[model samples]
Target: MDLEATKNLSASHTIGNYILKSKLGESSFSTVWKAENKITGGEVAAKQVYLSKLNKNLRNCLDCELNFLSSVNHPNIIRLLDVFEINLGMMFTEALLLDMVLRKSIWSSSASIMLEILKQTVIYMLSVSIIFHFCKSEYLQSQDECCVFLVLEFCSGGNLASYLQQHGRVQEKIAKRFTQQMGDGLKILQSHHIIHRDLKPENILLSGKESDVVLKIADFGLSRVLPDNHVETVCGSPFYMAPEVLQFQRYDCKVDMWSVGVILFELLNGYPPFRGRTNFQNIKSSSCLPFSQHILPGLHPDCVDICSRLLSANPVQRLSFDEFYHHKFLRIKGVGKYHGQ
Candidate 1:
């Protein structure tokens, strides 16, 4: 058997040098697994994406993910280790061809005509295959069920979203610590001119044991390199999305600071500052930061100041990356030790 055939047989449990153990999470087009490196005996995350399930926009996001993760190395950002592709099987390809023929109501066509259709379909699949960075001629020959696997550093402590769910609101000192790490990561992104359009708690991960867990930013699916000109793409989760993005205005990296503010607010208050059933509702409700009456009075003045400025409705008034990174709130020292509530 050839390499593709070998891959098809083993890919259910293994890919490259990693043996997939259990599923970590999944989305519409991809699944992430916790895997063990066979040679090094280390843990890692294996994110697998099915090419057939991707649309044009999703493909672009995948390209951005691969490009950004491959280029950067930061302690506060998730690291990409390896990437590879696997072909499902020839049987799967034939099944897809049959399904297409049946859908078109051409099942009773002549063998020569069916052969022509099969050839055309194979050509189409191959054309789509070229969009991937790791496309191999041999892998394209299978013409169906190709999966791209991204090996990444594993975070054992789950995401900040789940952490928040388990611990509710965190103390100011802990929240500040998390904010500082996020700032450190954003500094790297700023240097690279990359904007993490999605910066929710779900995309920030905890990577160590309880006593000394470190926060690392993950999930770059919505990230993009901002050029000199602004981009008007209205993308990102509504709750943490910037007001400018929610209003569909042209935006730059300052939009990310707005998201950071939302995350910070959520960290301190146990819920986002704004709640809405739709984007318009979110924008309408977010005209002002609705700090909890009970919690607002107790927060430090600098904390309140930074949050208010970062969450400013106008991007121009919002804190720039440099300003945010060096804000007095993040630079403040000598806070009392925080014991979890």
Candidate 2:
């Protein structure tokens, strides 16, 4: 849309006591904004989807995200506060208000403090077993649809890749802590039968600042809920691709484990397990990360073993995501979250 058209779209968009403040991010079919609840005086991340694109697979993706996030209460998973469609009159004729209060995010205010407050809120919500099931009060006809908006808790910190670039390779202690949390997150997903197909560092978000940071798995657009034992989908980033995925063979959740291995390798060695001058070379090469303790001087033997098993070329040989949590390395509680990064 032209700037003038974009302004026209913005002007007519509003919900009960919530005013759009700033744009947070956007995809081809959606634009997510940082909105403020005027009545509650609290901030939140709002995702607005173009109603024009909500047909077939695009609609299915949004529905999947809503279902998965609503059932998930893990600290490592992103939270969905609300979902509703705004339509008709090119003004605020309908409003779906949510009670969940989110704190200010990185763009506009005190981020670290906001995260601490949100952590407490998450604990309370989970402890009390407060869950909201997805519901649609009304569905507009395909012709009258305007937009679908989703409210989510803000993840203020940058992605793990950005953090890695700023701080270099993190020491083993911090790396293990992060690895353990990532495993825990995956374990939760396994229990829920959801596969986060995209498991690269960019989808792994750093939730807080400095020593108190938390890692969360974000961006579920490519994720799928597979109840069957396996699925045949040729997707995900090539650098983190499991052998089967690269070969276009049938695969399942184990592919996520392979990505985890690649992530850990990059964190420790400042590079991914797979690297090449060309994408084709990276995709076709069978070269695996050397688990030699000599090459990874500072890492413990157990850590090296864990990484090797996860990056196994044979999917059947790779450690399952749950197995990583029980690994001896993760059992050793690290000092704290990213002391430097």
Best by the lDDT measure: 1
User: How would you encode candidate 1's per-residue C-alpha lDDT over 206-252 as one tens digit per residue?
Assistant: 98787777999998877887879999888889999988888888999
Candidate 2, residue 147: lDDT = 69
Instruction: Report clash pairs, candidate 2.
Output: none
Which 10 consecutive positions of candidate 2 have the poorest summed lDDT? 89-98
Runs of candidate 2 with Cα error greater than 4 angstroms are: 1-17, 92-145, 277-279, 286-295, 333-341
Candidates in order have lDDT scores of 0.81, 0.71
Task: Write down the TM-score of every candidate.
Answer: 0.79, 0.74
Query: Taking the tens digit of each residue's C-alpha lDDT, what string does model 2 give over 186-267?
Result: 8878887888888998888878777988998877777878856677767778888888887778898888988998899888
Worst 10 residues of 1 by lDDT: 1-10
Residue pair clashes in candidate 1: none
